[model samples]
Target: MEILWLSEEDVKGSLSMEGTMEAVEEAFREAGRGTVQMPPKSYLIYKKYDGDLRTMPAYLEEMDATGVKVVNVHPENPGSGLPTVMALVILNSPKTGAPIAVMGGTFLTNMRTGAAGAVAAKYLAKKSSKTVGIVGAGAQGRSQLLGLAEAFDIEAVKVADVSLDRCRALEEESRTFLDATFEISTDIKEVCDADILVTTTPSRKPLVKDDWINEGTHINAIGADAAGKEELDPAILRRAKVVVDDVVQATHSGEVNVPLAEGLIALEDIYATIGEVVAGKVPGRTNEDEITVFDSTGLAIQDVATASRVYRTAVEKGLGIRLPFL
Candidate 1:
C-alpha cells in the first residue's frame, strides 16, 4: 500500500484558518449528534522529563474519517530551541484498516485548538466583542489570535507573559499578522479584563482572579489540559456559564477538572458542551451580562477533521511524497 507523508510545512501550508474552523465546527456537530466515536485521551506521564505523551484516536462516522494522534507536551523544550508541544497524526481507512496518510500534527494541533476556541467565542461571546486578551504569548496564543481575527472584528489585543521578551515578540507578530493594536502588559489582571480572554499557559495554579474578569466577558480556557493544571480561579467558574468540550474529559482533565475536584463546582454547574451549542441543541450566550467560559481539552475529533482537510488538500495539490508501505 502507498501512504502519503506530509511534513510540518506541508500540513501548515495546506490548511487555512477559515477552512479549519469550518471543519472543526462540523466535527463538533458530529460529536453532538452521536456520529463520532472519540475515546478519552490516554496519557503516559514522564515526571523525570517534566512532560507527558498523549494518545488520541477518533472516528467520525458521518464524515467517514478516522485518525489517531500521538502528541507530547514538554514544558521545558522552549529553552532548548524546541516547541513545547509536538505531534504526529496517522490517517487510516476505517473499512480496510490501512494507513492512508501520515503527517506532522503539531501545526495541525495548534490550528484546530485555535479554531475550537474561535468557534466557542463565536457561539458564546457578545457580538460587539472588540478587545481580545491573551495570557500566554506562545504559539497557541498566536494561533488563537489568528483564528479569532477570522471570526470577530477585533480592534485591540492585550498580551501578558512571564517573559517580557516573549510578550514583545508576540506584540510584534500580532501587529504584523492581526489587524489590531497590540499592548504588552506584565499584569495578568490587565489581560483578563477584555471583551474576550484566552488563557493558554501551562500554569498549575490560577493565574486569573475572580474579580479581574468583568461581566459579559467570554473566556476560552485553553490551558489546563491535564490534571493539576488550572488557570482561572474556581470562584470564576462558579459564577460563569461554563461550557466544556466533553463532559467526561473536561471533568477529568480540562479547566473544570480542578474546580470539580475541589468540590467547588458540580456536574450541574456545566451548562452544555461546545458541541451541543454548535449543534443548536443548547443556547449560547443567552444574555449580554452573562459571563461565559469555554473549557477546551483538545478533542481527538478535531485532529481527525483537521488532518482530513490537510490530507485532501495535499492530495489535490500533490504536495506530499508518497511511499509504499507493507
Candidate 2:
C-alpha cells in the first residue's frame, strides 16, 4: 500500500551518465534478444498550446523492470519561463501489477535519451572519433555532449544554434562535465564538420543537406520524433547505413518517418536496428569510409530500464519520500 515518490532533484541525484549508458545499452541488447515488451509511444496533441503529450510503457523481462512514463513537449514553454519538456514515470510490480514507485521522468528522460545516442554511437561510430558536431545547443544537445564525452575521448566540439546565448550557455555548462574546446556558429553546415555529428533540432524541414556532410561521419539524429518532422535530407539516409531504435516506431515517428512517407526511402533501406548492432548480430562501422546514421525515437524500454535502476538506488540510499496512498 506504500509507494516511493521521488522529486526531480532526487531523480537527478540518483542517476549518473555512466550508469545510464550501461543500462540503456543492456536494454537494447535485451531488445535484440527479444526479451522486452514495449509499445510505441501514444501521443495527444494540443493544437491550441502547440504542445503534445506522450505515454510510453515498457517491460524489460530480463532486467525485471516495468514502468510507464507520461511526458509532454512544449517548445514555447521557455517563453513562459518553463522547460519545453517535462515528464513523470510510474514503476509497478510485475508480479501483482501494483505501483511501487513514482519519480520525475523529465531528467530521467533526458539522460536516457542522451544515453541512447551514446549507445548507438558506441557501436556505429569509428573508434578514432575525436571531434563532435551538434545542432541545437539546448538541453538535449548538452546532454548529448555529456553522453558522448562519457563514451569517447572528444577533444573538440562544434555547436550551431539560433541563439548565441544558448550556445554560450551550453559551452559554459559543458565545462563542468565535458573538457572539450568548442566552436559556436549560426550555420548548421558549419557545425556538421566532425567525426561524429548529432542533430537535435526540431525541424519539420531538413536542415542538413546531403553534400555538406562528408563521408565517414556518424550522425545521431535526435530530433524528428513525430510523423512529419525530419532533420536530414532523405538522400543522406539513401547513401548512409541507417540504423533505427525500432523498425515500427521509427517508421511512424522518427527521422526516417518523413522520408518513408514520401517514398524517398523504403523500409528495406534501413540497414539494421541499434539493438542488432549492440547484440553483435550486425556489423558496425564496417570500413570507416561509409557514413552511418542512427535514427532515435526514444524507446519506452530505455525509460523503464533507467527508472527501475533509479528506484532501486534511491531505495538503498534513502533518497525519495515513501508514500502510503498507492
Candidate 3:
C-alpha cells in the first residue's frame, strides 16, 4: 500500500516529451479502435464564482494505465496569486485497484494537452509548414509552441496577446527553448496568417475571425474547453476539416460545444477524431490547401497514457519518494 509522492520536478524528470508523444499516439489509436475504456469527464460547475471542477478518469487495458485527474479552472487565479488552472493525478494499479501514487498534475495536464496539439498537427498540418502563430502567450501558449515545433521545422513564431508584456516575455523565453525567431504583435490578425495557428486564451467570445484564416492553415484550438468559451467563428468550423480529440468530450466542452449546442453545426459535420487519423482509420491532410482545425478538450486517455509513461520512467530512474505503506 505504498503511496509515491511525485513533485512537479520529479514528474518532469520522469517524463520526456518524445516519450509522451509516442504514448499519446498509441492512446489515440486505441481510442479510435474503440478499445479504450474512458467515460465522459464529469464536471462540477459553480454558478456564483463562474468556476469549474472536472474529474477525468480512464483505463487503457491494452496499455495498462489507469488514473483519475481532478482539475480546476478558476479564471481569477492570476489576480489572486495563483495559476488559472490546477490539477492533481491519482494513479492506480489496474491489476489490484490499489492506489500507487499521487503526483502533481499541472505539468502533466499542460504537457499532455500540448502533446495532443502536436499529435493533431502531426496529422492535420501541412508537411511543408514552418511558421507558427500563437494566440495567448501564457503557460499553455508556450507548451503549444514547443509541441508544434516538435512536429514541424518551425523557422519563426508569431505571437499575439492582449498584454504586450506577456507577448514580449514569450518572445524572450523562446530564445532559450526554441531555435525559431519570434515576432510579437498586438493585432490578432497579424498572427493568423501562420501555417500553424494555436489559440490558447480562455476567451468566452470569438477572438480570431473566421475570415482571418486562410487556406492551408491548421488551427489548434486549445482555449475553448468550456461551454461558453470560443476562439473561432462557427463558420470556420463549418468550413474546415474539423477534428476533435474526442467527439463526446468536444460535444460537451470543447470548442464545438457552444456551436453544437446552438445548432450552428451538426455532429455529422465533424470529419473524424484525431485518433482516427493517428490510427490510420482516416486520412489526414489530404490536400495542402484545405483548412484543418483540431479541437482539443484534453482527453482522459492522454492522462492515462502520459501518466503511465511518467510512472514507468519514475520506476526505472528511481525518481520519486516511495512510501512503505504498500
Candidate 4:
C-alpha cells in the first residue's frame, strides 16, 4: 500500500488556528461525552541525550478518525540547525485498519497544542483578561501567545526566556506575527504578572514563583508534556483551580506528573477536565477572583481532530499530491 504524502508546507497552508480551535473544542466535548478512544502516551526518556520520544495514539469515535503521532523533544537541536522538537503523524482507516496517509506533524502538533491552550483559556480564564504572558520564546511559546490572543482581548504580550537574544527575537517576531505590542524580559516573575500566564518551556526546574502570580491569573501550563519537565511552582497548582485535559494522561505525562509522583496532590485535586467544562458538566472559573490553571499534556484527540480536519480540507481543496498505489 502507498499512502498519500503531505509536506510541512502543505500542512501549514491547509490548517489554521481558528479552525483547529473550534474543531478541538468539539473533540473535547466528545471526550467528555465518552466517545473518544485515547490511551495515555508512552515515552522513552533519554537522559544521556537530554531528550525524550513520545508516541501518542487516539481514535475520535464520532469523527471516525484514527491516528498515531511520534514526537521527540530535544532542546539542543537548534545548535545543530534542527528544530527542538519534531513529529510525524500517521492516519489510518479505523474500520479497515489500513494506512491512509502519512502527514507532516510538527506544525500540526504546535497548532493543536495552541488550540488546546485556547480551549482551556476559553473556559478557565476570566472574560476580562486583556494581557498575555508567555514563558519560553520557542515554538510552543509562540503558539500559546497566538492561541491566547485569539481567545481574549489581549492588549499586550510579555515574553521571558533564559536567553535575552531569544526573548528580544520573540518580542519582534510576535509583534509582527500577532500585530500587537510586546515586551521582552529576563524576569519570569514579571511575565507571570499578566492576566493570562502561559508557560511553554522545557526546563526541568520551575521558572515561576508562587508569589509572583496575581489573584485572578489564569495559567496555561504547556511545557511539562513529559515526566520531570516542569515550568511552574507546585505552590501555584496547590492554590489554583486546576483543570487538566485528561487526569490519567496528566498524572503520568503532564505538568502535574512530578507533583503527582511526590504525593503533593491527589487525583481529587484536579478540579475538572477541560472536556467536562466544555461539556457543561463542570463549571469553569466560578469566581472572578479564582486562580485557574489548565495543565495541558497535549492530548491525542487533538491530533486526530486536527489531522482529520486538515486531511478533509486538503482533499477538498486538492492541496496534496495523490499517490498511485494504496
Better of 2 and 3 by TM-score: 2
Q: Which pairs in model 2 have colliding backbones?
A: none
Candidate 1 ranges beyond 4 A from true positions: none
TM accuracy, model 4: 0.96
**Candidate 4 wrongly placed segments (more than 4 Å):** 324-326
> Stretches of candidate 3 above 4 Å error?
324-326
Pick by TM-score: 1 or 4, better one: 1
Tell me the tens digit of each residue's lDDT in model 1 across 149-168. 99999999999998889999
Whichever of 2 and 3 has more lDDT, that candidate is 2
Question: Model 3: per-residue lDDT, tens digit, 69-114?
Answer: 9999988788888888888898998998998988889898888988
lDDT at residue 56 of model 4 (Cα atoms): 90
The ten-residue window of minimal lDDT in model 1 covers: 171-180
Model 4: residue 204 alpha-carbon error in angstroms: 1.5
Scored by lDDT, model 3 comes in at 0.89
lDDT (tens digit, per residue) of candidate 2 on 1-326: 89999999999889999999989999999999889999889999998998899999999999988989999988899999998889999999999899999999999989999999998999999989999999999999988998999989999999999998999999999999888889999889998889999999888999999998999999999998888899999999999999999999999999999999999999999999999988889988899899999999999999999999899889889999988974
- Report the backbone clash tally of model 2: 0
